[model samples]
Target chain A: AQSVTQLDSQVPVFEEAPVELRCNYSSSVSVYLFWYVQYPNQGLQLLLKYLSGSTLVKGINGFEAEFNKSQTSFHLRKPSVHISDTAEYFCAVSRLDSSYKLIFGSGTRLLVRP
Target chain B: EPEVTQTPSHQVTQMGQEVILRCVPISNHLYFYWYRQILGQKVEFLVSFYNNEISEKSEIFDDQFSVERPDGSNFTLKIRSTKLEDSAMYFCGGRQSSYEQYFGPGTRLTVT
Candidate 1:
């Protein structure tokens, strides 16, 4: 079984300011990590994922995340944010198997103020 | 690019009534899943279907909840009797392989 924890329930930042959203997970085995974004009245959109090869993963909208294995963390970051970046972000994990069922964290609401 | 599509963007139903949420997955995808998010809550997986059968399901997928792939392209989630707690946004997803899953816009189901 896999579980994800997103410590911050909400994060507020000014436009053009850098931001980071923390996420951690617990699993007995290797797992796949993913980040998803949900805009107001919209569906979940895949932001990025970490399967293997790289510790730092870059995603759409100038966002990126780094997978820290020793710390069991996969934190999302952006050099600068825009008001349009205001949305809910989720961290999810799936065990390294064929099931592909994802366990998600309680999302972090990003409020990018203009 | 092909994407997963869901029908009836919003649905209102009386308590104890039945409702069916529909989804059309991306072509050539073999796996499908259903998840729900209550207001201000995390998205929770309900079930996963593959090879025309349920491959995995969570405890939340009770007897009242059932899923079927009626046609080759359509996937449906049927609630035998809805309750106030069942009100939430339901999302459908399809995966082509083992990687990223494409999600539909979702159907907001409101139980009165």
Candidate 2:
């Protein structure tokens, strides 16, 4: 079974500041990594995914994540955050050869303050 | 871009009442799934369906919880008797084989 862990519960940052959300996973087999965002009272939207190839994956809203095999991490990063970037972010993982059911992290709430 | 859509964005029900949450997955996708997230909690998988049959389910999907694909364009989740703990945001998902799953906005259920 693959499991995901998001290290932080909340991250507070000022507008135009850089931000990072850390995520780690454990899986016996190869896995796919993903990031999702949810605004207040809204459904989750896919931010990006790491299927294979390049470890660095870019996503919508100027988000990017690096899949590091050595550290078992897939941390999301944004060079400069905007006030609209405030939302709940989740990290998820699924085995490459298994069912579509994804294991998700607890989530990190990004508070982009002015 | 095509995306999954769910119905009855919010539902309120009494204890022991039946509720059916509906979803319309992206066109041409073959796999479907249901997941739930209680307020301030992580999302949890409930079940997965493929080829008109349930492929897998979690312990949370008890006898009272059932899923069906009544037609080509719809997937439904029915809870026979709901408890207060059943209150949560339910998300429907879909994907083509060997691809990332797309999520619906979700139906929020509040059992009073």
Candidate 3:
């Protein structure tokens, strides 16, 4: 069975500060990784995905994540964040064979303080 | 910017009652999916539909749940009998190809 684990339940950061949300997955075979964001009272929005190619993948809103296959981790990072960046971040994984179903991690709440 | 849209931002229903959630995807999407997130829990996949039929479903999707694209434009998820445990945010998603499943604003279902 495939599963995702988000290290932090909540991350507090000041405005204009850098932030990193850690995620790890357990899977026997290769998988696809994704980052999603959900604002207050909104749906989940795709931030980025790692299917193949370079390990470093850039996503919307100046966010990026690096996929480490050896560690089975895909952590999301942002150099600078604004108050508007406060949201719930979720890391999801899907098996390469069964790509339709996404296994999501317990979301990490990003709290940006002004 | 095409996007998926779900109706009934919130719904409150009595236990054992039937509830239908509707979703409209951006034109030309070939696949549709349903997922749910209980409060303080990770989002869970329920089922996936393709070619007007169910392609895949999780264990969470049982006999009580059914999906249909009745009019070819509206994708609906029907719960035969609602339970208190069914209270959660239900999300509808659509995909044109392999990756990038676009999700809609979830419908918060509250079963009393």
Candidate 4:
């Protein structure tokens, strides 16, 4: 079994400011990590993922996440933000063996102010 | 770029009524899945399908839910009876071989 925790429920940031959304997970087996963004009334869009070989993974829209095994964390970061970046972000994980179903976090709402 | 498409973007049905949500996944993809997000809740996995049969399902996917690949291009999720609690945004997803799954715009089902 696996579970994800997104520490922040809402974040208010000004444009061009750096932002980070924290995520942590617990799993019995090796896992794959992903970040997905959801605009209002839409499905999730893959921002980036960490499968293997890299601790720092870059995703779409100038976003990135660093996977920390010791801490069980994958926190998303963006150096600059645009008004268009305002959306709900989700952190998800799948078991390395099954790799079929995804367990998701509660999500962090990013409100980018112009 | 190829992407998944779903029909009847918004559906409204009465309690105990049946509803079928339709999806057309990426042509070459072999794995399909259904997920739902209730208002402020986290996205929850309902079921996963491969080779015309269900590979896995979560506790949320109950006996009232069924999935079928009726044809080469169409994959459908049928709810035998919908409850008011079933109102949520339902997303259809597809994947070829990579673990990364692509999602469609989603269908909003409102059960009254």
- Report lDDT (CA) for all predictions: 0.95, 0.95, 0.94, 0.94
| Cα-based TM-score, every candidate | 0.98, 0.98, 0.98, 0.98
**Residue B31 C-alpha lDDT in model 3:** 88
**TM-score attained by chain A of model 3:** 0.98
- All-Cα superposition RMSD per candidate: 0.9, 0.9, 0.9, 0.8
- Candidate 4 TM-score to native: 0.98
* Least accurate 10 contiguous residues by lDDT in model 2 chain B: B93-102
Candidate 1 CAPRI assessment class? high
Pick by lDDT: which candidate is best? 1
Per-residue lDDT for B1-112 in model 2, tens only? Answer: 8878999999999999999999999988899999999999999999999999999899999999999998889999999999999999999999997668899999999999
- Report residue A84 deviation for candidate 3 (angstroms): 0.5
- The residue ranges of model 3 lying beyond 4 angstroms of the native Cα positions read none
Error of 3 at B23 (Å): 0.2
DockQ of candidate 4 compared with the true complex: 0.79
Task: Count clashing residue pairs per candidate.
Answer: 0, 0, 0, 0
Error of 3 at A99 (Å): 4.7
Query: Each candidate's chain B TM-score?
Result: 0.98, 0.98, 0.98, 0.98
On residues B12-75, what C-alpha lDDT tens digit does candidate 3 reach at each position? 9999999999999888899899999999899999999999889889999999999999998999
Q: Write candidate 4's Cα lDDT for A7-107 as tens digits.
A: 99999999989999999999999999999999987788999999999899999989999999999999999998999999999999988877368899999
Interface C-alpha RMSD per candidate, 1 decimal: 1.0, 0.9, 1.1, 1.1
